[model samples]
Target chain A: MQDKPFMSSLTTDEVATSLRRKGRWGLGEVLFWLAAAATLFFLPERHLILNEIAIIGLFAVSLDLILGYAGIVSLGHAAFFGVGAYVAGIFAKEMTGDPLTGLAVAGVAAALLGFATSFLVLRGADLTRLMVTLGVALVAGEIANQASWLTGGADGLQGIMMGPLLGMFEFDIFGTTAYAYSLVVLFVLFVVARRIVHSPFGLSLRSIRDNSLRARAVGIPVNRRLVAIYTISAAYAGIAGGLLAQTTQFVSLDVLAFHRSADVLLVLVIGGVGYLYGGLIGAVIFKVLQDILSSMTPQYWQFWIGLILVVLVLAGRERLTERARFLAGRLFGRSAGAPRTAPAREGRP
Target chain B: MTPALETIGLQKRFGGLTATDNVSFRLEKGARHALIGPNGAGKTTFINLLTGVIPPTSGRILLEGADITRLCPELRVQRGLARTFQINQLFPAMTPLETLGLAVSERKGSGRDWWRVFGSDREIVDEVVGIAQRFRLADVLDERTSNLPYGKQRLLEIAVAFACEPRVLLLDEPAAGVPEAERHELLATVAALPRDVSVLLIEHDMDLVFSFAERISVLVNGGLFTEGTVDEIAADPRVRAVYLGESVDE
Candidate 1:
């Protein structure tokens, strides 16, 4: 055997530079955010729906942090969302009505809940996680329902008056202010979430999601990472909920409903998962489709949405996304490169 | 001096079957040891017990004289006990760069940092690059682990464990299913591990066992059958009788 030490031709600096470059923002990302900003001036009449889209998109992004990146399947994500809405609502009504303050208060409240409940998820498989998460949302909804004095119960928390943004821009009925506020909040939080997923902490979560046993073997405290991410995701969801309550100036029990969780999950299914853009793109597609379809057939819009989901699943989300990327690359004069799919998991020997 | 890893009267019973039967074993510091056994001889189970993958039915395990029988698997790894799976257990979606980065970052106590970019930490990146070069995985560092060849994946499996900088390494069939052309590289890397890290190789390949292990322990029916130096085991008739089913001369 050769006794000479093995040497790699690549320098550490070169590799580090390349990795750093990968995390840099591309033109597409810049254009995507610019287009979102442009909606304020270009589509004045659509501000209300656009505001809703921004809030939902933020919620979806929060879910992606745990579901897409960490491989945590949470059906009770709305638990945090509802907590944020109620906390913001009560904060505005009882404490302070400052929108940013309400958001912070709601985020912290949801984070505490997330930290408390994250332990339940550490013990189970996917199915168990789903059940536990679902139970958490259901239980949260019930608490909100039973505490009529605090939450206004089934009637929902009303008469919440949010102060102007930064004590300057008053919230207008046309939703121009709300859209701008929601958009800015979404962008800031998305930037933070973007940083998180590309961090070492984020990489460990992906490892746990892919194969937790090997993750543990590599000396990663799997449960702790899960707890931390779950808590962060909850805070994100809470912030999204706070946006919804602040924008509309109302809090509803529907925020904690099961359909909210199911809907956000469906949004991820539409956009793709793992990558951060999936949530944002999926939100736009989902909300727009709902708007267009519901206008055509209000009652059967759900049926059409369900059909689309079935089609997306049957045709394979990855293949469809690859095709879309290929088309986009051709249109934009860039090489899409070879389409890649994750290799099928190998069974144990 | 204390043994690197020790198991005292370790036993595991699965219903009516005793998989690991009262096996008390010790691997001295910096020992190059191999555990050999027949099919279903409880080789993997013993490693699992030592790594704390599964709790023992009774008895204790120690790492460098520290009682670690009740330690969780990740905790054992934190305490400097690292292991590879019998099957290739790896994150299929992550590239080798990301995989090694995770290990190195975790070891350096920076795995929980969410604010900084992953490769922004120059120290961790340098170590990851060094380890990747040492394992000959620098070329495929950007390739997804599942996309790499079986041989390279196997190397990565060991590379990740090595990244932990463990005091004692347990390699479970590291060469299993590797092709003839790739087997030599795998075994060479295993043989070339740092001397300060005590290694316990669990393998069915006798050639690898003989070439790499200075000391050999034979396991039969979940119990320690015999243990001796390479020459002693090579000349033992009872070991042959158990392995080859040959009649023993009285």
Candidate 2:
């Protein structure tokens, strides 16, 4: 047996290098984004579906920020999404129609609501959080339904006219511009979220998630961190909702519906949680499955989706991913070996 | 100088049972103190009250002469009070590196910086590495914490608390479940803790308590039974009857 050193002799630079390497963007990440961008030219005819996927993907990512990292179970996430949708729609109709400005306004509005409701989440366990979140969404939907003059009530907010993307690209009927706009917004926010989860702040959040008692023992202000992440997640969801409003040129009561919250949770489950990319990956699979199944059986498409969910849950995500990695490693050989272990251990950053 | 940690007339009652009964305790600055009592003697309860895990029924806790009875647990930690639990309260999913990083970063007030990557700060990395080495966890720093040996996990429990840079450290039975071979490392590390940091050790191991503590406080039935030096406690027959007599038989 080799003798162990009394102290680590590793230089600061070496330690820093190893630490930075953990957060480095891997080739898989680059390839994933490249494929997303390639959809613009390769899948132009499917831009409408692509636009929807981008918006929902962003929404799923927002939920992942709170549920995945902070372990805050929010069932009323759609409350923020709905708020963003209405705020952007109104801002475009009554204020300036600039898509970027509308998105900003909507995000701020959702963040405010998130900040206010964040305290409610701090007081409860998982069950309480779920109830509170669900309650918030229900209340939001009812307000949108009753406030007919302002929100168009159950009729839905209509005639939302959005200005060009960056004062240039118009939102066309084919959704080419809308897809591009949503994709960019998703990418930017994804980068920010990525940065957060990789940071010390993010590390503290994971600690809080794993064991709040120890987190507090170590001086992590658990409640404050939860509130911060919830607010930021609210902003992300709001932006995603704003994207939907801008791209579709309409806001509906369904945006704040309970189904929206459940659907986002389903998306996270499909993609896996804690890791950021699960939402994006889950969104792609969910939206595509919805599109294909809906075409085949428009009335009973949800039955097939539910079936898939059951299979996915019963089979277990970790086992399935391991199997996928084994197959990919066999196909690609040595190149996939290192990357597999990296993500398997840490879950992808 | 004020006591590093002081509990004035601390009392805790769980319904009809009095867990801790009106006890005033002080851990002097830079002192090596041991708090020993048999199981159910309310040693853990006293530590819990000091750390603000559960509020005392009626009492005032002071850290460095400032009243901290109403302060929350994390606030106490922030005020340079740190502790290890009787049962390890570690993040099972995190590695030792990440655990130390969290502790150190939080101490340096960078735990809230969401925009900056955790290891991007050179100082934090250096300190984490330093703490890992000091605690003999350098080799297994990257390994998941749950998979670590019972001894290393205990070391990590101390290492994380040490990383908080606390003025007073409460170690609750650090050697409880450690096997014989690993006890040396655990004890040596405990002995080698910085002198400037006051240590209050709570242990059932008479050997560790006797060797490590300059001053000892004994508790019985949730109240202070006796206080003395090592030799004085060793000679006290009442202490032996209430506590050490059972340990000697074991």
Candidate 3:
């Protein structure tokens, strides 16, 4: 046995050193939150677009929690999204119109489904997990279609009336209230997620993702952690779906559609993975690009979107960010170390 | 008295081949034991069975008198069984600091706390730093494990096992690929391990096995051929026959 360490294992100096190295709120984080808040004042005309971005951003964040952090590839995240939408829609119409209660109900319903299905994911590799998840979404979509009375079948669930958020600020025609409400929900959940991803549990998830056998050898409960994170991510997706149902007062079969799941995956890849802001940034770019391309070409918009995804994939997210930084330097005449504030993506390729 | 670890009637048959055939062994508390065999003698297979990597065909594994034959690998580790891989299995992307910190945190049951920031956990950070220093990994603690030198990577592998505060440590080829210059340091570290933790070292190097292990077990054809102290094994005619190119029949 080697001699004990010099510090006598007392933990005084080491603790001090650790505390000193502790990461606090960096300038980039502050700036990112500030910009998100500033959107309310600067983008009044695009409230609907911003509201859509917030909802999709939440969905992408949920995917990142499982896919990027936990290394669980899910192809049918829309299952939870659709579950939340239908549950919230049904709850508001049949029971209470209170938005928060509806959101809670939606999250719980989706989380239960996620917890039940998590066992399937725990047994397989990436491809198997993908197929299982996609199958789940397909099954869920069928259920929604077949159960016409509760889910309104193919036409979708309509006549959802959400009471004012906090019983004060009513949802509006221009989506102003919806934007603020969604942004607040997004911000609160983002904080919770940010806290989670930086904590010891978050670090353990990354370790498991990197090497699960070693993780198991080291006494990390690999299966339990995966199941926990998967369930939480499902709840997050459910909340995003609930936001959509509440904001629009309409729930459709598209809530559980394959396109919804596929779109979120595309958004995450475009923005980047493992990083919290990847989903938010990806949703913004995905929605904005969709908006512009659909208006311009209408029929061929998907082609343009596909082209952008291919370009992003080929260039690599890190390389594109580097090139963007270089171009920005050339354009703005700013030096390399000019306190550049990017959201916390960590930029690992 | 109960041995620290014991395997009773342990047998593993892969199809028709008996990789380990009814091999029973005992390791006393604080005993420095070595399991050495020629190529294909199932040294690694035995270690795998002990560490819960693979289930034995028919046997019982007892840790301090409690049967742990059916426990999962992680549960085994939690029960104080730790092993370093024959091949380096450190996480490639994580720095030594992060890897060690994670292991320590898990040991302390803070592994699932999503609210506590890792850097702020002084006790864990301190323990990790101390382990890194003891393993001579202080300078490269911040460097990725994959980028570290091979010898250093081997040391880090041991360091990670130590982070678990294990009662039984299975060291498989601790100095297999280490360079000649670093071999002394590696052996010295192994030699100096605290006596409270019993060590079962699986090594092919005769010099290391003779010097480090208080008792040695020789395995031939997936079965225990002989067992004795360093001197007794050295002088035994049967042991000599196995090593000196003489068949047991002869």
Number of clashes recorded per candidate: 0, 0, 3
Give every collision pair in model 1.
none
lDDT of 3 by residue, A19-40 (tens): 3343455455677778888988
Q: What ranges in model 2 sit over 4 Å off?
A: A1-11, A333-349
TM-score of the second chain, each candidate in turn, equals 0.96, 0.98, 0.95
Candidate 2: tens digits of C-alpha lDDT, residues A168-240 = 9888999999999999999999999999988999999989888899999999999999999999999999999
Task: Please state every model's RMSD to the true fold in angstroms.
Answer: 3.2, 2.8, 3.5
Return the top candidate by TM-score. 2
Which residue runs does candidate 3 get wrong by more than 4 Å? A1-23, A323-349, B240-250
Name the 10 consecutive residues with the lowest summed lDDT in model 1 chain A: A340-349
TM-scores for the candidates: 0.95, 0.96, 0.93
Clashing pairs in 3: A1-B192, A1-B193, A1-B194
Give the Cα error of residue B124 in candidate 3, in Å.
1.4
DockQ of 2: 0.61
- Give the DockQ-based CAPRI class for model 1: medium
Q: Give the per-residue lDDT digits (tens) of candidate 1, residues B34-139.
A: 9987878898889989988899999999899999999999988988999988799998877898899999999999888998988999998888898888788988
What level of docking quality does candidate 2 show?
medium
